[model samples]
Target chain A: MTPAFEKLQKQLRQLPGLGFRSAERIALHLLVEKPARLPELVEALQAAAATVRRCPRCGNLAEDGLCAICADERREQGVVCVVEHVPDLVAMERSGAYRGVYHVLHGRLSPIQGVRPEDLNFEALFSRVADGGVRELILALSNDVEGEATCHYLTQHLPAPANGVEVKTTRIGFGLPSGGGVLYADSVTLKSALDGRRHYE
Target chain B: MTPAFEKLQKQLRQLPGLGFRSAERIALHLLVEKPARLPELVEALQAAAATVRRCPRCGNLAEDGLCAICADERREQGVVCVVEHVPDLVAMERSGAYRGVYHVLHGRLSPIQGVRPEDLNFEALFSRVADGGVRELILALSNDVEGEATCHYLTQHLPAPANGVEVKTTRIGFGLPSGGGVLYADSVTLKSALDGRRHYE
Candidate 1:
């Protein structure tokens, strides 16, 4: 392979879900689909790279040192939603419900992966809490093993539950669809279904 | 939504397989998990865009004006593999089976899509063949309807079988796995199996 093609392939393989075939497909797309856009995409890539920076206050990406979330005057400052990653930030934002700022943990702890507390921005988070303006910290980590572990680890560093600062954890509201048949239900799902039943008016 | 987050969402949505969910996922990927790699990937994207170009002779992407296949002195001079796009060229190369030059058609004849002969490099191909030396034209277009139509259209423009230029086409080799059953086969695959069957000897 030519150096250019080799380099392109190597770089493409680094992206998620891109194998050799998909890399070549994307490369061909860059070549054929509005060839002029190639330069523009390049410009966008470089601009995004050079300019994108994490907000010191909220961990959201911003063109300036502080992310847009941190700069926004209307967003609730004292109630911060802490998430494992930026996608979580976007997801919560997409719901268009949350009015508070976000603090991205970047990742959760996994002992198998050797991720320690220092590897994350836990110290900064503790400092943010200790400074005393924040009233609530909503832990919005995924409901998976690592997320659970990280949440537990984070709680240990927080002010005591009685210290007047409320620390709440969020989980998805999920269940069987209304009017769905129970004949096809599995045991665990059925159990959750029965366990979660509420009284009607 | 903050301007930066909104802008980022729009760009990520334009990427392949990136819907609202996937786009948010990528954003999170950028925000978290080796965030350093995101900038590097963006840089590589920009660099690839700046440097990659089409080979004048065959239309494959070239670091220089000519692609590696076109520049190589060792490839068979009289044989050319005609493909609808550059991705096909790369796929053929990946198998490490063929050492021949390629001519990228850029696209196929799609009446519904309004793609015509003039939109492709047909004129250049004819001129290249008439200039003398190419003895074989191998059609490696997709197995789709458009690819078949393109092969027929391409064959119509070339010299007759008597001109010492043989016209041939190839299909990918595929079949059921050793332990697989016929009931699982799709219609098109079953047809391919029957069409590609060989004598037991």
Candidate 2:
């Protein structure tokens, strides 16, 4: 391999989910196998980098102002789903189960990693809540310590609901995933599943 | 995802080994998590696309004239390894086994797919062989039908091994890979291993 090729591979390896071998394969694919696509990929990446920006309201990806979810009139603006990252928001969207918009923290409260409430996109969320249109806030964060801390911090800091109504706060439940067997389920998952059990007819 | 983000994801999805989910993750990683790295990636891609090109002599990646392998004086110029693609060349280089230069066909002879001799970098190879330097032509092509067809085509078209000496054409051997159990080896691999069995110590 040449210096330029190696440099390109190194850059590609820095991306998420790309190992050295996979990065090499991708570099070769772009440089040799389908050379024509390389320019297009570069153009697209530059275009996205120049145009895409954080949604002013929710911290999700946006081009001009708000993200598509925040800008859409059909989505429930009053019901906000809070997630740790944009990918989590994308995952929730993929499920098609949530009709509400999302608030991306970009990170959770990780004390060990020195991540604080101020380090995240918390101020905007607080402002959104304080502005007083939210009816419900669903915490769709991961079932981890940091996620719990973030959820706790958000609930503790929440302002009083508009019109003297109480704001309903909920957390996404943890349990065995679809198509997963109990025998293979971890103990924590099993415990959550047990705690979240529904009454049988 | 916004239009720019979606466009970026679609372009990423077209890359080898990236599925929809992985593409989405990468897009979010660039746009939201580590936005600073996006411009670097774009620059790298642009730089590679601008500077890198096929070595006119051997069809390997090059920045200016000859590829690193071809330009190197220490490498064995007389021994040329022919591979189906640049990634194969990169793989061989990674092993640190072969010290010779390479001839990347960029593709193989796939009659069914309408890949012909003219479609490959055969003429340059023939010219290199005809110009009188190559002593050994190692065929490191794949073990598939098209690979075999390509090897056969190259052997038949080779200009009388320069200086009237034998070209010493050889294909990469097929055998059970290191650390692989014989029982787990597929039938075709088993047959090849048996066929290529070495003499007793």
- Best by the DockQ measure: 2
Writing each residue's lDDT as its tens digit, candidate 1 over A20-132 gives 75666555566556556555545554455556777787776776667778777899887777777665566566555568787878777989999988888677677777777
TM-score of 2: 0.83
Off by over 4 Å in 1: A63-77, A93-101, A108-119, A141-201, B1-5, B70-76, B91-100, B109-118, B140-201
How do the residues B10-47 of candidate 2 rate in per-residue lDDT, one tens digit apiece? 99999988999789888878877788998888888888
The digit string of per-residue lDDT tens for model 2 on A100-175 reads: 8889888889889999889999889888887787877777666666777888888888876556666777776557
List the candidates' TM-scores in order.
Answer: 0.67, 0.83
- Measured against the true two-chain complex, the DockQ scores of the candidates, in the order shown, are 0.27, 0.72
Q: For model 1, how does the per-residue alpha-carbon lDDT over B44-157 read when each residue is reduced to its tens digit?
A: 666677677777888878776778788889998667877777655665665455667888888889999999999997876776677665766666555567876787787677
At residue B132, candidate 2 shows an lDDT of 79
Best by lDDT: 2
